[model samples]
Structure formats: C-alpha cells, structure tokens
Target: MKKKFKNLTFKDALFNIANYTVFFLFTLACIFPFYYIFINTISNNDAVQKGMINFIPVGINIRNYLALTSVNDLGVSFVVTVARTVLGTGLMVLASAFIGYLVTKEEMRNRKFWYRFLIITMYFNAGIMPVFLNLSMLGLTDNFMGYIIPSIIAPYNIILVKTYIESIPRELEESALIDGAGYFMVFRKIIWPLSKPILATIAIFGAVNHWNSFIDSLVYMQNAPKLYTLQHRLYVYLNEASNLKDIISSSPNAAAMALNSKVLKYTVTMVTLIPIFIVYPFMQRYFEKGIMLGAVKG
Candidate 1:
C-alpha cells in the first residue's frame, strides 16, 4: 500500500527555509571567530600583526606553539590542569550522586529540611572575603584542595542528579532490598549504572569549571608559584613579560627562534580550549539527554 502525504504549503516551506537559514547563520557567527583565531595562530606573525590574516591563512608557522612549549613551566601547568580537572570532576560527580541519592531516600531523616537547605544555598552565596578568610583558616588556601574540595558539591548539580534519580523505577530497588541487598549495594549495582547520563553531564560541567577557573589559584596560591594553574599562567602571559626570560632561557637557539609574543597569546588560547573541544564531543550525546531528563519532575 502506498502512503499518501499532504503536500507542503508555500508559507510552511518558506518558514522552514527561513528557520534553517537563520540557524546556519547563527552557527557561522559562533564558529567563524574561532576559525579566524586559528588562521591567525598559524599565519605569519607579521601578517597577523598587519591584519592581513582574517578568515584565511597568510602562511603556515607552528613557531608560536613551539615557542610556547619551550617553557618548562608549560609542562608543569598542563599536568596541574589535568590533575585538577580529573580530581575535581570526579569528586563533584560522586558527591552529587551520593548526596542526591541520599536525599531521595524515604528512610533518611530530615530529607525535606536538608533538600530545602541545599536548594537555598543555590541562590545564596557567602561573600568572597568571608569565604577566603574561612579557606585561609582551614589551610585550604595555597593547597591543591583549594580547587577540588570547594567545588565538590554544587547545589544545582545535586538537584539534577536527584531529579534524574526520581525518574528511575523504584521497583528495581525494592526488589533488590527484598533480596537482602543494602541501599549501598542497590546503589552500586543499580542506581549508579542507570545514572550515567546525568553523571556525565555533571562531570562535564565540573571539568570545564576547573579547567577555566584562575581566580582560586591566584587568590589562594599567592605565595606558591609552583601551584599556578594553566589559566593563571595564561593571564600572566597576557599582562606581563617577566616570565618570558625564563621561557627564552630554556631554548639553546633562543636568539635565532623569534618568539612572537603577540601571536603566542592566540596559540595559548587555542591550547587552553583543546581539552574542552576533545572531551565535549564524547559527552555531547549523553549531555543532551541528561539535561532534558534531569529537568523533568517525576
């Protein structure tokens, strides 16, 4: 049997065309700036400075990256960045999942009160001075824990995890409980597996936050130069040349290899963004579904 379909109206066709055209334009607007930066990064420094490189390359040169990498501290910064991203994201995801699961339990005392308390903190922030003073007193300042410990629990993430858990069939946990499995066992075997989507979402959020944040390192690790993050290093690169001599000293042929400090900024920016670009694509599918599912109220 042949299926019959109604022909599209002229108005509807025009509307669809307009919508797609707008979407394409919007995508181009967002992407072209990054593309322009990439073109500039690889283009000749003279061409870039002369404004000759725009959406197209003038010449290819990887010298910016080479010069940037010649700095020994860049390697240290990269290691620090990776460490914080992994530990911070992992802790946030685990903490949110566990706290979220606990709050949803009927047997847990003060569930509503605890939930309300957490939700209230989402809108309420302790002032920066107070937070800094508290962190100083606790010795979290100038410590690696400054990044991981403070960000382990975000109330919004907890809510998303809890909402996602609410959608899961309770009958699964009930059956496990009937089989003499404890709550932790049930969570380990069942809830954790089922909650992968939201976990990935929260992980992405936490990872990006830790990767991009520089203020914590600046304020907390003021006395500790070795603990500066990649982001803080980049900020220093942009604002001053005090560190350039240290970097230049690393290269044996430093006199011949001209380091274009101007273009190095773009190269460093691209480098900073690379991990996010790589990781986001893998999580994108789960990310979309997770946010939607987490938004739904059971």
Candidate 2:
C-alpha cells in the first residue's frame, strides 16, 4: 500500500506540491506577524530605535518584561484577569450548554420562538450607555459582577451549541428513557460526557474573551484601578511606554524602566496565551469528536 501510494505520476506530484505550497504560504502569512512581534520584543532599544530589528533580534534585551513586572498595580491586575477568565468562562459554558440542551427539545413549547429571540440578540445589542446604566441600576458597576455577568449568556455560542445538540440521535434519548433514566440523569450521564469537545471549545472561547476584555472594565470600573484586568494594564503600559521620553527627561532611570515595560508586554502576552495553548491540544481530540457527534445526521 505504501509503495502503491508513493508511485504517483508527475502530474499528481505537481498537484501535491502546489497544494502544499499554498498551505505553507498561508501558514507563514498567519505566523509572520507574531514572529515579528516576538523579535521586536527582544530587540535592543537602540537597534529598535534605528529600525534595525526585523525578523531577528538585533541586540537581545529583557528590559521590557522587567519594567512591566515592576509596575505597582500589574500583579494585582494579573490575578484579577485570571480569576475573571476562570469564573466567567465556567459560568458561560454551563449556562450555554444547559440552554442549548433545553432549546434542542422538540416537545418544548415555543422552542422556535426562543431560538429566534436568542439569535436576534446576536444581531442587535443595547449600546454601551444602556449597558452601563443597567449595571449601575443593579449596583454592579466597579464590581467583578459587572465584568462577569453581562457576558454570561452569549447568543452565538447558544446557537452553535443548540445546533450541535439537536443533531444528537433521538433514539439515544428514547433508549435512556426506556432504561428508566430521567432527563437530568440522561443529560448528566450521556449528553454531558459526549459534549466535552464543544464544552472545551466554548470554555476556551469564553476564557480568551474574558482575558482580553478591556472595554467593559474601562467603562464600568470607574475610579477602580485595582479592578483593571491584564489587557487594561497592558494597554496602560503601552501608553506609558510610548510617552517614556518625556518621563525619562525628568528622571534618568525612567528610560530603563520603560524598556523593561516593553519587554514585559511581550512576556505578558506570551504568558496570557500559554495557558490556552496548553489546554487546546488536549481538548482538540475531544473537540473534533464532540462537534461531529453533535452534528450527526438523523
């Protein structure tokens, strides 16, 4: 079989090479920006200033990272961001999964209407002012609840999950009922276990969203510097780092500090991304299976 497969004609070999070339170029296009950022992060300030840094680091330096960690409020913001990602993603996945399952039930009254209502929400949203006003009414402004609550129910995730769940074989549910299993039991034992891939996908999506969220934090967290998330902290750092020349003219040590802040921005970006990257590989196997199972034809 190997010999036969390897015995391709010149035309076939050309086609295969062309296919791989396109994919390789596409992959490089996607990856080059990240590579540039990484290189820039480690390159020397003088070299960076001279526009010498390209795909490679000109003079390696760790100053940017050191400066970032030395900032007073960054540590607190890191912890806050991690906590929000965990709690917010957990709540979102659970709520979405339950809602998905509920909506998939054919016998449920007004199911179509509920699904349509949920889908409509994805297209239309109350503006930031209304959201802020509502949060203030609920006394959630400047609170962690403000960050986590508003994002708990995602309409798009709900629709994806619902479509997946509806694809589950009805016979499986009938079998569970015949075996004297209640709806909850069937869901817990079978549906939940089978839905791990989609759950992981949703969890990762939610976590990434929560971790990167800055607009909500900025709008709702008035006078609450301690409540700033990692993204917000990074944003502030970048802004401060850009203005470092003026800051350094007043204080000689500020240039070194700014350099450190630049390095730290890269380090923090890597740090924030590492957890999700570690998680995704393990979940990927289940994700493919779950998606296929959830989308199985009747």
Candidate 3:
C-alpha cells in the first residue's frame, strides 16, 4: 500500500501538498485576528496602551469585564439584543422559506414576473430617507417593530433559497401530487424537508445579520433606549465615555474614571462578540452545506 501510494504521479503529490498548504494558511488567517483580539481584551489597560501584548496577554486582568457589566444599561441592552436576534431571524427565515418555495414553483402563475420583481428589489433598494419616511407613516419608528419589520424579508436570501429549491427533482413533487397531497401539504412535508440545507444557510445568515445589526436599531429606535441593542449600547457608551473624559478632565477623580473607560471598551466588545462566536460553531457544519446547496447543478 505504501509503495503504491508513493508511486502516485508527481502531479497528484504536488496538488495534494498545494491544497494542504492553502487550507492551512486560510485557517490561520481566519483564526489569528480573533486570537489577537482575545489576548488584547484580557491585557491590562496600561499594557494595551503601551502595545506590550501580542498573541499572549500581558498584565492580565478582569477589571474591564467588571466595568462593562457594571454599566447602567448593559443588562437591558443585552436582553434587547437577544430578543431581537431570535425574533427577527425566526421571522425572516420563515418568510424567506415560504416565499422561496412559492417562487420556485414552475406551475405558479407569473413566476417569471415575481422573480424579476424580487431581483429588481435586490439591486435597487429605495433610499434610506424614503424607507424612514415610510416607516414614519406606518408609525414603526422608535419601536421594536422598526428593527424587526425592515429586516423580515431579504431578497438576496430568498433568491438563494429559490435557486436551491429549483435544484430539487420535480419528479418528487409530481409523485406527492399523485398521492393526493395538496400544495400546502407538499410544501410542509416534502419541500421544506428537502430544503434543509438552504434553510439552515438562510437561518444562520439572518441570525448573524440581526445579532450584529446596530445601525438600523440606532437610526430607527433612537428614541427608545429601552429597546437599544448591544451595538447601540456600546456606541452610546463610547460616546458618553469620550464626552465625560473631555468635560471632567479638570477633576482628579474623573481622570481616573476615564482610564477605566478604556478597559471597559475592550471588555464590552468582547462580551458582545462572545455569544455570537459561541453560536457560530454549532451552525458551522450546516453553513457550508447551505452555501454549496445552490452552487452545483442537480
């Protein structure tokens, strides 16, 4: 066996080596940044400020975490972020899945027109000002609905899912119909089950998007601090810390307080990132399947 393996062509050996090299390098590149951030986040403020820490933390401390969790609105913001990510992602996935299934049906009337309409929206979104105006008209501004509603239907995801569903053999649908299964029954029992890979992909994408979304929450729900997401809370904290340092510089105690703010920033960033990072590994296997689902022709 060893002799036979060694006798493989030079071209095959070279290809295998090159493939492994590229894969190793790619993995290192992806992991290094997060490792660097983790090291820096744990390092003391003075060590971080002096650039003394690299792959390993220097003068390690948990004071940053203490400062972060001790902040007035951090708890509220955390709760809001969790709720928004779950609800928003759930709604988007359900809507995208149903719409994707519908649009993939060749027998559906005006399927081509609906597909073109969605493709158009994917390329040409109404500007933000108009979106805000429309939201204002609907009284969704400064509410939880504002953040969740606008993100419920992503055209790009719908298209990806549609492509994946289109790859499924139509013979399956015909067989189900022959068995007297209605359209709804076929979709729920057959199509949805078959479309798991794409659905998982869309779910992960939507969940990550909603979890990391801060700008929309900031712009639309500005008036509702109670509804502020983690990102928005971090933004507000950074702004407040900056302003406080500037205003309170003449006071001795305030200067020391601002030194702590630097630590808090890194800690809060780590805290916000940790939950999402933890969830990612669980979805990693599904993610590759989902991405590749629509790429290959059936």
TM for every model, in the order presented, reads: 0.93, 0.83, 0.86
- Of the two candidates 1 and 3, the one with more favorable lDDT, higher being better, is 1
Ranking by lDDT: 1, 3, 2
Count of backbone collisions in candidate 1: 0
Candidate 3 lDDT trough over 10 residues, lowest sum: 244-253
Per-residue lDDT for 1-298 in model 3, tens only? 8997789899998988899999999999998877876787778777786777777888776655554444547889898889989998889888888898898778899999988998899878788889988998999988888878888989988988888888888999889999999988988998889888888888888888887888787878878889899998878777777643343444443345335456555666778889989998988888898889766643
Clashing pairs in 2: 63-259, 63-260, 64-259, 64-260, 64-262, 64-263, 64-264, 65-263, 65-264, 67-260
Best by lDDT: 1
CA lDDT scores, all candidates in order: 0.86, 0.76, 0.80
Query: Cα deviation of 101 in candidate 1 (Å)?
Result: 0.7
Model 1, position 174, has a per-residue lDDT of 96
Pitting candidate 2 against candidate 3, the one with the higher TM-score is 3
TM-score of predicted model 1? 0.93
Candidate 3's C-alpha runs over 4 A off are: 1-23, 59-61, 242-259
Per-model tally of clashing residue pairs? 0, 10, 0
Worst 10 residues of 2 by lDDT: 244-253
